[model samples]
Target chain A: MSDALPPGATLGILGGGQLGRMLAMAAARLGLKTCVFEPAGDCPASHVANHHFRAAFDDAEALTRFADACDVVTFEFENIPTAALDAIERRVPIRPGREALRISQDRLTEKNWLRDLGLAVAPFAPVDDAESLRAALDRIGAPAILKTRRFGYDGKGQARIATPDDAGAALAAMAGAPAILEGHVSFAREISVIGARGLDGAVACFDPGENLHEGGILRTTTLPAALPHARATDAVLIAGRILTALDYVGVLGVELFVTDTGLVVNEIAPRVHNSGHWTQDGATIDQFEQHVRAVAGWPLGDGRRHSDMVMENLIGDDIARLPEIARDPAAAIHLYGKAEARPGRKMGHVNRRTGPAA
Target chain B: MSDALPPGATLGILGGGQLGRMLAMAAARLGLKTCVFEPAGDCPASHVANHHFRAAFDDAEALTRFADACDVVTFEFENIPTAALDAIERRVPIRPGREALRISQDRLTEKNWLRDLGLAVAPFAPVDDAESLRAALDRIGAPAILKTRRFGYDGKGQARIATPDDAGAALAAMAGAPAILEGHVSFAREISVIGARGLDGAVACFDPGENLHEGGILRTTTLPAALPHARATDAVLIAGRILTALDYVGVLGVELFVTDTGLVVNEIAPRVHNSGHWTQDGATIDQFEQHVRAVAGWPLGDGRRHSDMVMENLIGDDIARLPEIARDPAAAIHLYGKAEARPGRKMGHVNRRTGPAA
Candidate 1:
């Protein structure tokens, strides 16, 4: 009976991971059932979901069954193949649709879209081979990053080139794939604007959080982020512009490099980002619930924070310290139910809420 | 491996209410598998869980299968039959264990336990027969209540005996069930303490919340409860005592009646209680995760509030208002994925974080 999607409607989730797991949990709190499709068995999302289809993303039969069973589909990761997206769209509504995915799936397109929206992005050029890599390195200069156009995450598929001679090796390392060479921004700090955009064009943004990374893994995000209010406002507006331009209908996280002049768009994650985990314990409505509301065709929630927030990732073997972490009166711990503690894997996170320092 | 139950461990959950549903979601975050055994076919917990055993609680075969699938079994509701607990215990650990359930399942035993623990309780008497009811009525005077000793919840299985003539109707309404008669205290307010107890005897409690009821249904719970610091400590201590006495593991809620004289114990919920829903939005570690930690043998988390809180129930027809509620800048709405919205059913809840009033 809600103006949003009615109860009993199924929400299809693509890529079953901790983000998808949290989103599914939030959706269930609103009378929405979820069917998760992922190739991985015992996916964290599937464990608590209504149903799961454990088939490869490209399996046409499984895709058809998944689309046929769901009313609306959204994804946890932006790297889903366009073929799978196209197939699912024929059967169900795919919010923040295929166009958004296509733009975000490739590094070159994402930078181009941000520039087209009049947002500041680092100088970049597409590099298709060793020849292009050399020319791009000459034009963009040394000490840049070479990232593959697709299927890259968490520092994978990208390499830092400090010398001209490193270009060919970096290109070879990426398997001679379509890649982009981007100039580095010596930013003061990294921050992210976590927000939701509804189909009706409404936008809600949480306060930006200063982020820190260790070995390419997000280590912590602390909020009341060390940014001027004007910069934070600009960051939120930049995110809104991207959402509006793409007709995005769910939560999207925009990573930005805070520079002396202003905020420069770094990259866009079409789904929730690890930086927003603080919202789970620090805000009126967390990013996961906001994403659920957006995809369910419901009204957006307030993204206001009531306290100072810090979310720290429990990576690799850090998970073993959960027992000690649990004793902290100020910390909120969330484990992702992942079985393995291999190197650089994200096992869980903890959020600590504090009053503003005197 | 963790001192707490590790990933791939089977978590046995008793009861199949929305609380269990949420708990299953939380446990899955830690790579835990779940087997939910509830009597209903379409229980809220069954919708997203790994497997569901739809059988009466006393079914031995089903119980054995349930125990076999689970390494540790925790319940959602406290009214589970003791026989079922005995049967399941042969195979798996049942956190909040059988003794806790027995004391909480019956009003008389619960009150006695509270009294024995040196907590103040409303003056109560056992009323198994009409003669005993009359004696209790004469002793306590009018404006009291007669509640069935066992199987009572949400104000069900009880009647107010406002006058001498009303006692007969109240007794008859109880259907000859063994009951307890309690004198009403002129309390200033009602509050509840929600806490978790670990296997290692660590206890953590959220800030108590003031409760409001309408039509015999819990309507709302507001945090930073209208209690002095000493009173809140007393409330938490009462909860800790119950958990310690029962040798309880997992989350437990102790509802309290606040009189001008002091706080009096009202009842105990051996499982997660609705009054604790604020923790889902206001605290660093919500009750669900804490319960998961307890059953999984992990450490209990710090149960401290990060913001002032308000939790409002979405009952039956009220769930239809989710779209509007979702629009509230301050509301974090959550609805159970129940297929139907039956009258008086708890369809969901909305937890809002706000600044404390001046």
Candidate 2:
């Protein structure tokens, strides 16, 4: 295990999206410098990081140079080319480890891994071909979502099936890639637990946020999710189990479905998650700082939300309201600095505080 | 007057000290880009700004290049050699204006300007020679401070005259420079108001913070200062008067002395003030962001102090206690990312919240 990093240490971050931009800024707050490695020129994170390695993620020489400069390495996203990680991990430590990345990268593997740990998750089965998909559909039943095993995000690369007759069309929707057939849980509400694991074995979780989705994209997340105290404690404990089981060493976002039976895990992200953005305003030390502290081997921060907050994502044209939003005293606007406001793009988010909860 | 700046606009900051570093970070948080212009390499702000202009402040070519890139120009320090500001001001607007800078850059000018505005300030006199110094010392009385009219800060370039015998020595300390001898105001406590004025001429002010100095350097600033409601209102009004008189369009830090009679103006800083650092944790929007918004021609932010906080400067070796401080869940650390822990240097600051006040 690596020792804790000093203040002046350089943190090498892969990817230069809004997540990386926020991460770099958080690292700066703690006296750590960040160097961002991104293929795109003038990316969001490049404007804030201490340094920018403008090169592809798969470039071996660039990865070597990056690792040489960084005391420890971390990534904002999980889709980093495994070979690039292999090249850098040998030279420097990568928090959340390769095992966590490998498992979280595939939907079928992640579901099976969670089931093996005896955690409750949605019923899912692997579907590699049309025959396998047909067989899995028979076993998992109709009214399922067929999602690509890898690189699927934001309702992309996924098709919903209503009946057995629609199965072939759903399989074709996968474009012949590996897929997973997941049985939908009749959830009453959706909530997410943002948790962090430190360099030591200790784990800490922030208050869960009740999530609302529109068109398969996150619209809002309300903090202190109106869950029963016992259930809220269970959500935190479940997130801890997942982190400890994966030997995770960073902030993880676990999206859960609040069903009639109990809480069921829908997915887990290995880095700072969108649902945890409320912590930026409501918590003492936010999820971005938590991720930085964990990756730097520092102890986890206080996870309690000091105030009640509702986070709303500013997708695409929602940015037009920024001028008026800027005048709102209750809202804290966090824009990603993206140039183009394409439809469905994650432009930014606003955290509106609802006062401190007793 | 300039229109409001959009999120992608670049802000040109002239100075790369801790103030600029914090401002750059704040601009990044708002999705605004910043380029730092400083003569020194690897300065604190350089690490966080999107672009670094490593040239002297008076470098006309560099200033021109910088102005061409920026939508507006603002500065962290007031001593930005008038010629450089002239070069940049022709290309884009500089918030708080050159008039504010000219008055605040010199002690005598600032005091006179404040006194002319029907404000309460300590009795003072400008001294150009030893004879004038003796005359002024006699008028202002002994047990006073003889300070350089220009470039005096952190109690440097200042000498104490305890008695008539000490007059000559104190005058000699200026080393052939203009000086100001001001009579001391025996005050109850020191307080400062951080106020912001946007392009639209609306003023917003944070609650006053009680300041404590050790060895002529700011040690800590406590928010929601122990003051009567009327005195606080007077302080805010006085600050607004100064802002309106100067036609200011950015955050201003006004130091005041609470005397038996009323509030006496100590001095005013034209940019974000160290005493206002508590707003970063205690308020919805901080002084840094307020300054950014004002300079960017945006509306002022909410200046309410949401929580009680005490900001302690991590000067020099004080940073050694970071590990212990980090363990204190209430303290949010903001390090400037300086490589060395030089004596008396402000390496970082810690904001310890005392909880939300009623």
Candidate 3:
């Protein structure tokens, strides 16, 4: 409580995408100012943030100024440069800390760390080069994903290995970057739990949402995921364990594969997750605000669901359907103020409330 | 729909108070940019707006710049100077139009217009000087209130005349400003209807909320107000008539007195009102977004209430209880980023949801 940042304090954000924009808006709702640090000009977050420090991640002078102006710092993405975090950490504390970032930044590290924590994860092996990739394939088998250990997002920097003969193409796809071979796990459905840990060590989790992806990007997330009472409970418990183990002080999104036997860990995002967008309209408090509260040292808000919701993303040209979507009485639309509708880009989302939460 | 502004278009807002701040955030959520033209430095809306033009209302050069940058302009307050609107209207359209402002800015004019529309209002008469005050007092009777015709809010610019003997003092208190004398109406409770009129001549109104005021400032507004279905329908009908009569565009807050016989119109605000704040948490689409959607020439959003809500204002020193309020599991707190909480100033509000809407 003594370290809690007051309402008027500034929160520095390390990215300027839609996540940062939503985070900035949530911070504003709580009487907190936000300063966004991003290299892109006229980025989404800059539209709402009080200040925009538009400079490269390695620009020490700009980072210093941004850090000096903020009382606490957090990030919307996990891929921020380590040097930038080091510069900010010298001036203000960063919630979720460097440990979560270190582990989640690399796919191999994240998978190994989850396994070491006694969590159920997809069978995986590290791949450094052609030799290691070949050896890992022998153990992990074909029909696996070859993903870069770092800097991969939105299905980027990866190749699918359909058969042993395709290993050459997949290895070439890595382009010399460190990679991981993950054996696919057959699951009934994919679900994610949005959990938060406060500075006081209190944990809260939103109801798990069943997810559907298209082109390796999340397309829709339906709340009150179709799972048995025990399995849902298990999912929440697993998320709580991860948050506690990380000593996390902000919201974390844990994706899980619900198989017949048990829930298997897919991955964990250090910041707010896309699958949790349903909570904005379904829960008492949203993931963005919950993350802000945790990072600011405030008590975590209740993340209880009050409405059954289905959140559908509008990618690129899908924005052309906004006029029709706006006509739906139950739809709550949230569009990022991006200038262009580039293909595969997330332009906005609509959270449609079906009914009261059961 | 043809005249509707695109998502990336700028919506100019006048006055950067909490209402403006919320409106700016809502606009951002809909992928529209906002430029706040406020005289004060570091005002609330500036924190979330895309641009802030900090200049006096009379600054012609600045007004031109602000209006030039916007596709359509709207305001959060009704008392914007006429000259400022004149300059902006020449460049871009202002929603809720000049007629709504002309009527609402003057208490006498508003009452007369409501009455002329075959609606019920408190007995009111124009008061220009001591003679007119005495004459109006004679006609309207004692135990009335003398309020300035323009720029009166939060109980300021008003003086109660308990008896004819208090007339001289109340008249003098006006300081030569044009005034209106209105006889008090005995009512069971105060409630307000938040309604919107879209560019397509469509009308949508939220369920009325019972309001409580202390020291002439609104304290709380509870939804599902203790009114019969018939009376509630009548209230909504009264609001629709006003909107249609004025050809109003954007959201309006119409305060009403629920008398034993029928509902009496108390007053009307051409912009978002304090009593409507509960919509931010309880409704699918809030008043701010509804207002933005209307002014941007988009169709009106559903103003349906999804949950029963009680909105309590944190005025001045009431903000000290924020720490305790933050702990409430059902509370949705919204704070205005004000540097100082002067006496009677609205610092923030908390919306507590009791249950699902009936």
Candidate 4:
């Protein structure tokens, strides 16, 4: 590991979404400054920070200035160009590193990494063209998902080939992008383990949360996941193994499927996840703070939730219910500084404190 | 008393100190925009806000622009000029309005207001010059403090006159400014009631915190003060009375002396006080958020502390001890983004959480 970053040092963030906004707040609490880089004019992180470079990822001058200003850099989203990271890494250290990025950016590489780490993932095959699509379908069989190998998120750029006739529509819909076909895993519930790994190989995991999705967007996350104790232990161990192998230095979100037989890895997020929002009210240190502490080389705080928590995402029209939500004694609301409530956009979230037993 | 600032509107803050920084963070959580106006470069509030105006308070053009950009204006420091508020008030309402400033800016006026409000304050008389100082001493007696009527803070611009021979020296020390001579209160403890008052006549108060001062600077504040339950209740009621009588629209901090007879009003801070820093981690809703909610015309939150707390200020060299403090499970540290650490300058603070019973 490189030299530790002292307090009052600057942290460079690659994306300026709500995740970066929360991350900046956490960094400030630890006496660290944040310089957020984003392309949007009124990104959420800009409101809470003064040092912002509003330039595209390819702007070398801006990138150089950002690298020069920060002691270490981290990204809020996984879609950051590897070339931009390469240019900055020459000047400053980037935590969670580029190795994790390369594997997580593409679905096929991520799946392979999971399997290589001795983790159970869905059966999958790569598809580059019509011939490969047909061959992969023959191997994975029907009722498989055809998804772009790169840049697919929140259920976008994916289609289901349920029958022989649907293959043409699925292939045409995905266009010319390199893709992957995966047989669906029979699961009873969706759960995610949000945990952090330090440079010294210390792993701290938060309680797993049960998640619900609506129209391909996360709607709510409730703590005390439905998984059995042994299954939860296995889920955390799998996540820890992946982080350790990648030599990750920040929080990693592991999405899992709780099947009747066993737990299977669904996907991996190399940064703080939306499902971890409950930690802000329920735990001693939230996921953002934990990520900051891990990256800053501070000892990770206990991620135990003191009380049960229910976190609900305020998406588009759901923001209209803020007045009612504000009146609830058990609820704590957080709204991002987005101007318009567009469909599928994350506008805000409300976390409600529940009974400990629940 | 003025047009209600709705949830989506912006709140303007005059000073960019830690109190304003906390206020801006609080406003962000409520879906309200915060615009901080301060002359200094890289002011504390500027780092955690959506908009910041780097202009002097008396700059008419800049003040007009700032006033037009905000729905309501509040100040973090009481020494702001009346003319500045008059300009902003012509455009938007100023919360904890001009009356508070009028009282707080002049020691004589503040003393008279406390007496007028049917509250107990130190016996005092005005002194414009050496002749007047002698006259004031005859009425108030010796062994009292001679303080300037305006622009004094943290024991500065004041002198303790122990004898008739020291009256002339104290008067000369004040540089012929308007002043007040007051008999000091002998109290068992020093405590402050930090609370917020909504425009709709709602009031929320946190438990009183006993304060300790060193070298004329506040060093520590311990919550769940040793005062009797009846006295704590009286303190909250008195703070509510002052907030209502002044038509206060935001958080008001009332510092009191817990004497053997009863609680006496020492002074009123029209904005958040340093002694309330513990609320950042201990209280469910901090004083900063409470002020933002009151100014935004939103309902007040439960300002109860989840645990007992002791907040210690990190003055100058004290900041170097943060690494040891961070290792403690109960410590919540906050650092202001200040470049220099001059003697007696506040650099940051640490809040240590203890169980409520402590």
Candidate 5:
């Protein structure tokens, strides 16, 4: 609590995507100014941030200048360059810390870390070359997914091996990058928990949301996932355990597979997740504000859900339906202000309240 | 509507206060960019807006530049200079229009207009010199108030006429400015309705909230004001009538005194009102977004209440209690990012949800 930044202090954000934009707005709501560091001009975050430092992450001089301007630093994405983090860490503290980023940055590392923590995770093995790919396939079996060990998101950098004959093409899909083979797990549904940890080590988790994906991209998330009371409590407890383990001081998104036996960890996001977007409309305090509060060393706000909500993403050309969506009284629209609507690009989202929370 | 500004269009704001700041954030939520024109640097709105034009209202060149960047223009305050509005009107339309501002800028003009529209208002008379002041006092009786016709807010530009003998001092307090004397009306409480009208002439009004003022500044606004169902309906209807008469295309605040016989119109504001701040946390659609929707020619959102909320303003030294307030799980804090907490300055506000709406 003694390290708590005052209201007018500056919070530096690493990425200038839609996540950063929403984070900047949330920081502004708490009377904090934000400076965004991104290489591109007119990035979504720059539109709302107090300051924008447009430079490549590898530029040490620009990183120092950006770090010098902020009282505390946080990031919107986990893939920020290690050199940039190293430069900023020398000047100001980064919440969720380097360890959380270190683990979440690579698939192999994240899987090993979760498994070592006694958490149930999908069977996985690392693949650095063709020979290793064959070994991993033999261990994990066919019907596996080969993914780039790093820098993969939104169903990108992934190839499926339907049978033994498909292993060669799946291995070639790696394109000389380090990869990981993950065995498919039979699950009833997918769910995610948005969890937060304060500077004082207090943990809070929002209720799990059931997620639906299309073409390897998230399409919708509905709150109060169909789970028994005990299982719901277990999901929240699992999220809290992870936050406490990392000594995390910001919001984290943990995606889970609700199997017939138990919940299995599919992946974990070090920053705010698209699945948690419903909190903006259904809960008392949203995940963006929760992250800002944690990084700023403020107390964790109440994350109780007040309404049942369904959050649907408006990807790419789906934005053409804005006129009709705008007419829906139940929908709360949020757009990223992107100029082009390329296929699969996340244009915005709409949170529609179904009713009061059960 | 054909005039509807598409997403990514810039909205020009006249004032850079907290209301402007909130408006800029709301516009950003709807995928609209904002450019704020204010004389002061580092104003609240400037922190969130996409652009900040730092120039006085009378600076025609700066006003023109600001207007050139915007598809539509709106204002956060009513006292914007006529020349500035004239310059902007040539390039783009200003929502709520100039007629609303013309009547609201002067007390005498507003009272006359309301009365002519068959609405009940306090007995008022125009006063210029000593002779007129005396005549107004003789007609309106003692225990009245004399206020300057323009540029008055938060109880400034006013003097109490406690008795007939106090008339000379009250007149002198006007500083030779045109004035209006308003007769006192005994009332149980004060309530306000926030209403909006779309470009298509559709009107929507939020639930009225009872207000409490101290030192002539608003302190708190609580939803579900103590009023009969019919009286509340009447209050909302009165506000809709005012908006329809003016052909207003944004939010308007109508203050009413709950008297023994009926509700009396105390004043009308042609912009988002402080009392409506509760809607940010209590309703499905807040006043700021509603105003943005109206001005942008988008469909007006439903203004239905979702939770019971009490919005308390943190004025001046009241900001010192932030630590305690931040610890309250029920409080949703909104700070204006002001560097100094000067006396009587509005630093921020907190909306506390007591429970779900009844």
Candidate 6:
């Protein structure tokens, strides 16, 4: 509803993690100033953003000051506290809007939304208590995943059920929070599409990335994914449909399962996704910039891949290879500027160009 | 020299113009922090650098404080005050070393240094006064350029001796300052090689970017410069030789005139050059990062061009084309956060990729 932001306008970023760090860097490249809101003193985004508000997300005064200073507000994480949004929404517009966040915050709502749109999704049943867990297991079957309906990320807040007998433990793991039991779709491969929609209703989606995971954490995302041509096309169309349906004006990462039946929707992230990191080196316009553009009311850029790439995440102690990564001329290294590289921590990434640009 | 700077090390930047703005961004990509020293509040680099020292270049107290905080210092311009360097050199190492700056600070010294090294240069004579200017003009021949020995850039402090009769006014233009009169070389094309040398003596040179100038300011620099393959090789080797001769530990810009016989050295800038701007999109590692790496004692990246590119400068009101430039996916637009766009001011640049990356 607002006018397009000028080049020198300030972009207010919520959650100053690696995503926000890259976003701040991208905004700065476009001559836009960024103010990051994060409680941590050493948040990665704080290192690069023009200004930093070191306060709790729900700190009303801090939120007021940050929203007052920024020309536009956009957040990277979906789990942003409703109270925080409530405090800031009165001051500035939030891109992707509150509706997208409300649906994505709960697993059941995301699945139902996809199903309502006539998209294929893994069979899922909501579980609120023990009585419902048993009833849902009967409907969804064993060897399914029971995930908390809200507040989950990077393999957190979820448990797998091997059999019907294991349902109780999975239910107990939810700790009384609402849960969704998703039956395994027998996926051939995991793929993700990073889609963006601009303020003027223009939508763009990158080619699906063949994703690989290690211990439930993303390890690598390779472009030119090994998928049937039809499936790849289907992925982009589905992603665009979701973007348009939500009236989203920022990047959304849609996870998919290449199943025997077809491509099944896994979930959606209302921000730049890890699987899209290859865009930094392999594409003319990267996803971070795309998100920034969409949030600033600028037209969406080409999400087309320019080069073949393998984007590898440098989690935890993987940062020890910084020296080695630096030696390779083709290795486009991006470190989050985090102070410490604790085990299982995401420190940096390397996007290696494996082939020629398109 | 100290060991290679780690990823999180702080790099002190001497200037805060667009060049420094780019250097700070590149340093951030490498997970390094930058502190910029500039008196202006709205300097382009101040918008992105991690820390800023708002003080005059000649302020010894500020210089000492800056050096004390940084791991090492590197400048983005050649005209850094000697007194500032004198104050900081004892506290922190300055990359490219003082010798390169000392030689480049004076046109006569730079030319003589190149000639003494067996490098081809325009035939020149020193002029200290009107009589000497007339004598130099006669010796160097007409249709030559008369340039002040010190503090000259962008066609400033220079005049043309169009004919033998035009010497008096040209001498007066120098205002009795020491000057150099050099006979011009008829060239096929003007080109520049961006070369780098590390503290450990490794050298790398980017492919020459053939340049065009209007009103003495660079208008465009096209890669794959249309030079004979052998001449291009010679350009790189000559750049490397110059880097080694100066014991430089940072990026250097070497301008050359391609004549019928061979290449003739015009001058050298002891920092990142505008001519190398194409590397931002055409190479995996750009010149700014190369400069930062060299100054930080790290290995030089492959300076080989990946994609064919034409880097066009957006000077003055040319920035009004943002809407059009933003429509081109292949245009990597880099805008300096400068508020005013005075005529001849470099407001931004656009690197248009023309071919696939090699």
Query: Candidate 5 lDDT, tens digit per residue, B212-315?
Result: 99988999999989999999999999998999999888999999999999999999999999999999888777999999999999999878888888999999
Cα error, candidate 5, residue B219 (Å): 0.6
| Per-residue alpha-carbon lDDT of candidate 3 for residues A1-358, written as tens digits (9 for 90 to 100) | 5667888999999999999999999899889999999999999999999999999999999999999999999999999999999999998899989999999999988998899999999989999888888898889898899999999887888899999898888989989888999998999999999999999999999999999998888999998899999999999999999998899999999999999889999999999999999888887789999999999998888789999999999999999998888888789999999889999999999999999988
- Over A305-349, each residue of candidate 2 has an lDDT whose tens digit, in order, gives 789999999999999988888889878889898999999999999
RMSD of 1: 2.2
TM-score of 5: 0.99
Q: How does model 2 do on interface RMSD, in angstroms?
A: 2.1
lDDT: worst 10-residue window of model 4 chain B = B1-10
Q: Quality of candidate 4's docking, in CAPRI categories?
A: acceptable
Cα lDDT tens digits, model 4, B1-358, are 1344544578899989878888888888776789999999787888887788999988999999999999888989999977888899999988877988888888899889989999999889999987788888888888898999999887889989998789988988899888889887899999999988887888889889999999878999998888889999999999988988888878888999999999888888889899988887666677887788787777777776666789999999887776676666556778887767888888898887665433
Candidate 2, residues B1-85: lDDT per residue as tens digits?
2387888899999999989999998898788999899999989899889899999877889999999989888998887798898
Runs with alpha carbons beyond 4 Å of true place in candidate 2: none
Model 4 reproduces what portion of true contacts? 0.46
* Candidate 4 lDDT over residue span A1-358, tens digit each: 1445665689999999999998998888776889999989878888886588899999988999999999889989999987899889999999888898999999999999899888899999998888998898888888889999999877889998888678888988788899999988889999999989876778989989999998778999998887779988988888888889998999999999999888899999999999999888776678998898888887777676665779999999888777677656557778887878998889999887665433
Cα lDDT tens digits, model 6, B1-358, are 2478887899999999999999998898888899999998978898888899999988889999999989999998888889999998999999979999999999989999999999999999998887787787778788999999998877789999899888888888988888999997999999999999988899999999999988888999998899888999999999999999998899999999999999999999999999999998888889999999999887789897778999999999898888888878888888888888899899999998888844
Off by over 4 Å in 3: none
Local accuracy of candidate 1 as per-residue lDDT tens digits, B252-355: 98889999899998888988889998887776668888899887887777786766888999998997776677678788777777878899999999887676
Second chain only: TM-score per model?
0.96, 0.98, 0.99, 0.96, 0.99, 0.97
Candidate 1 regions with alpha-carbon error over 4 angstroms: A1-3, A356-358, B1-3, B356-358
Worst 10 residues of 2 chain B by lDDT: B1-10
Which pairs clash in model 2?
Answer: none
Docking level of model 6: medium
- Which pairs clash (backbone N, Cα, C closer than 3 Å) in model 5? none
Best by DockQ: 3
Cα TM-score per model: 0.95, 0.98, 0.99, 0.93, 0.99, 0.97
Q: Is candidate 5 or candidate 6 better by TM-score?
A: 5
The runs of at least 3 residues in candidate 5 whose Cα sits more than 4 Å from the true structure, single-residue gaps closed, are none
